[model samples]
Target: MASAPVIISAHLSIPDAELVERFVRASGAGGQNVNKVSTAVELRFDVAGSPSLPEPLRSRLLARRDRRMTGEGVLVIDAQRFRTQDRNRDDARERLAAFIQESLSVPKPRVATKPSYGAKLRRLDEKKGRAQIKRGRTTRNWE
Candidate 1:
């Protein structure tokens, strides 16, 4: 059996066996060629089933709201921008690499912050000024 292709990223590498690639005909303005040739590449990655991904990174990827991710934790990337099968294949691989790279970095946790006293005072003063302007615009009737 042939060894799986290895995809390298900044932090980790994934085997090509973890990825599933399917070729389909792209629907667009290409006259007859589009109908005859399967140029579009559909790359599928099993985020939940992949042994290559760490648990934390897998969870982070699954937490994403991208439409490309299926309910079953499979990430589907369609590469149809290029007409040629080879180019589309390369494009799909590139996109998969990018997604894996994105998962490598841990996001910084947000620190809880409170408004400073001076900031609160400034906000109140602005509101008071706005209220005064509105009050001054009121029409007064002199009998």
Candidate 2:
């Protein structure tokens, strides 16, 4: 309950109770701050067990191929791109919101189509031209 709820979309918001954030020492590019302070934020959300998410969204999030997903279905996001604790913390929450939002959108199914007759003929013509060029490169006795 440290901050406002994570807004995934206009209709969906995940409360702070559903999210867990831990501060850790960042690896690089923060000067002495990297060595002393725990600026990196590790945010965790249970995609499978959370009551906040709808079933379809939860399933879609779980089905995602991201390596961040744990075997227990927790989505862990690590944010250390900033040098400050507040910045990194916000980044982690923002990333989580964006991820959840991404799962909400369902892509339209792709409709397969055959190449046009003209396109097929053009491809064949290009292949013939290349073959003709290759044929000209052969060494002939010419005797």
Candidate 3:
């Protein structure tokens, strides 16, 4: 039987069909097993083509500066840290879920702020104190 859809958030759940998993040989430090078993998982999700993702959320995901995201809007995750296939699969799924969750919320607009008068005064005082210390180090006598 197929597993249930992966839940990312209360509102967002990714269907298993949208997630494509491929098993490949992992490189690095697993001795002979690395060459023998294809433990690494490559998870690919077509963010742009996915029907489940809303338009705004899709745009937000595409706006991210992650290298894993392709120009075509496909997000590729390679899981090779773990030696076991199951662990790597879970890791990839978790990462995909995390990425989706991040794009779910709209970021708050930043309010422009300036230093208060007291803060400015405190900064000026510190600068003056530093200047005074430097002035004291200068030799008074001309050699």
Best by lDDT: 3
Q: Of the pair 1 and 2, which is ahead by TM-score?
A: 1
In the range 1-143, model 2's lDDT, one tens digit per residue, is 37999888888999998898999999978678789999999999998999999999898998889999998999999999998889998999999998888889887899999999999999999999999999999989978
User: Candidate 2 — which residues are off by over 4 angstroms?
Assistant: none
lDDT of 1 by residue, 3-108 (tens): 3464756557777778788999998989999999999999898998999888999999999888999999999999999879989988888888888777778999
lDDT of each: 0.88, 0.92, 0.94
- What TM-score fits each model? 0.90, 0.88, 0.87
Question: How large an RMSD does model 2 have?
Answer: 1.9
Candidate 3 on 97-130: residue-level lDDT in tens? 9988988999999999999999999999999999
Write down the lDDT that model 3 would get: 0.94
Clashes of 1: 0
Q: lDDT of model 3 at residue 35? A: 99
Model 1 spans > 4 angstroms off: 1-11
lDDT of 3 at 122: 100
Stretches > 4 Å off in candidate 3: 140-142
